[model samples]
Target chain A: MVVRVSTAPFDPGAETNAFLAAGRGAGAAVTFTGVVRSSPDDPIIALTLECYPELAINQLASSIDQATSRFGLLAATVIHRYGRLTPGEPIVHVMTLAPHREAAFKGAEFLMDYLKTDAPFWKQETGPDGTHWVEAKAEDDAAKARWE
Target chain B: MKILYFAWLRERLNRGEEEVSPPSDVATVADLIDWLASRDEAFALATQKRSLIKAAVDEKLVAHTAPVAGARVVALFPPMTGG
Candidate 1:
């Protein structure tokens, strides 16, 4: 397992290739990437992500560990970015490998669900009007709850 | 103990982290929050919306009623929104 929280933008293609290369024996691999999307009503110019780096990493690692055990994953990777980013930029990437496709898919989904609510990252959107912190959605909490 | 704030709480409080030595009466996360809310207008205003607040004691998520007798760090923030 590999987990990274970085401020620098990453190449998703490169990251995917690296994860796939490392999982030499795994028969199935699943990847998910989250990108910043502009709101139609209130167009956002950029999004700022703030986090306690050590805490975020630790939480993500533990979540990954749970996913590995529950889904029987052979390998997993999560890369999340912090700091300011413009719309359309990638925010996170998750990849999972398992002997079969079901485990790989479920593992990737599980990691994402946990990361959405459990990670200690906060997002603020800067738009035409001004900067405002993004409110947490009830839907997100519900999404994470299903895995429990 | 070190007290950390994130997201709107940090912005509203106008700072991120601080070392606080709460009175002995502040024995739980709820108590600490009440004490903090009494410290400054910023804290008072920021903590007014209790439903939005979430906390971690010593880097582990805990309930507001959780004890904080020996905790070295406490973090307060809004619900997470990451993926």
Candidate 2:
């Protein structure tokens, strides 16, 4: 099932449980929660997420579809938050369930990795001194490349 | 012509979306970029790293040589840092 990518915070455990329950044949389930870091080298006081609403949702759904088709995931869900967010707040969450532990683990990682590098979202970080827009990290591209 | 900018490109351009009418000879994205740069100094600097900056005709990423004369929307962004 797909979760609405919204600014509202959600209970991670409940979300995880639901994903696991959906996968009746799956023996392993893994989840990842991406939170706002308290300190970043760029001096982020806060982060504001911007996206093309319809386009963002469609792209995310398409990514999930690709993962499911390629990996045979029993179930998965992705929740991403947008707009102004404070440090330590949840930015994104993903859960993957599969029959094997490896697929479960790998699938979760893949989802997050693609979401980082390919997803259509714009992030602007505001700091104590000034506000600077975020850029796609070389590290993120490298991370995504490993799975490809 | 709908032009969109993302990431640092947006910041440097100091604008997000704009409607533009390029010269009749602007047949490709490369030509359009040259025209845009000629309009302002910032465009020249920001577009200097043409290899690093990516372009998408409509929603699909395309190469610098891609035709843009008929494109309805054009997007420019730096290599993504979205994680």
TM-score of chain A of each: 0.97, 0.89
**Chain A TM-score, prediction 2:** 0.89
Interface RMSD of 1: 0.9
Writing each residue's lDDT as its tens digit, candidate 2 over B1-83 gives: 99998767788889998999998999988899999999989989998978767777877767789999878998887765443
Which window of ten consecutive residues has the lowest lDDT sum in model 2 chain A? A50-59
lDDT of each: 0.91, 0.79
lDDT of candidate 1?
Answer: 0.91
Q: How far is candidate 1 from the true structure (C-alpha RMSD, Å)?
A: 1.3
Candidate 2: pairs in clash: A135-B81, A136-B80, A136-B81, A137-B81
Report i-RMS for every model.
0.9, 2.5
Q: lDDT score, residue A134, model 1?
A: 84
Q: Give the TM-score of each candidate.
A: 0.95, 0.83
**Candidate 1 error regions (>4 Å):** A39-42
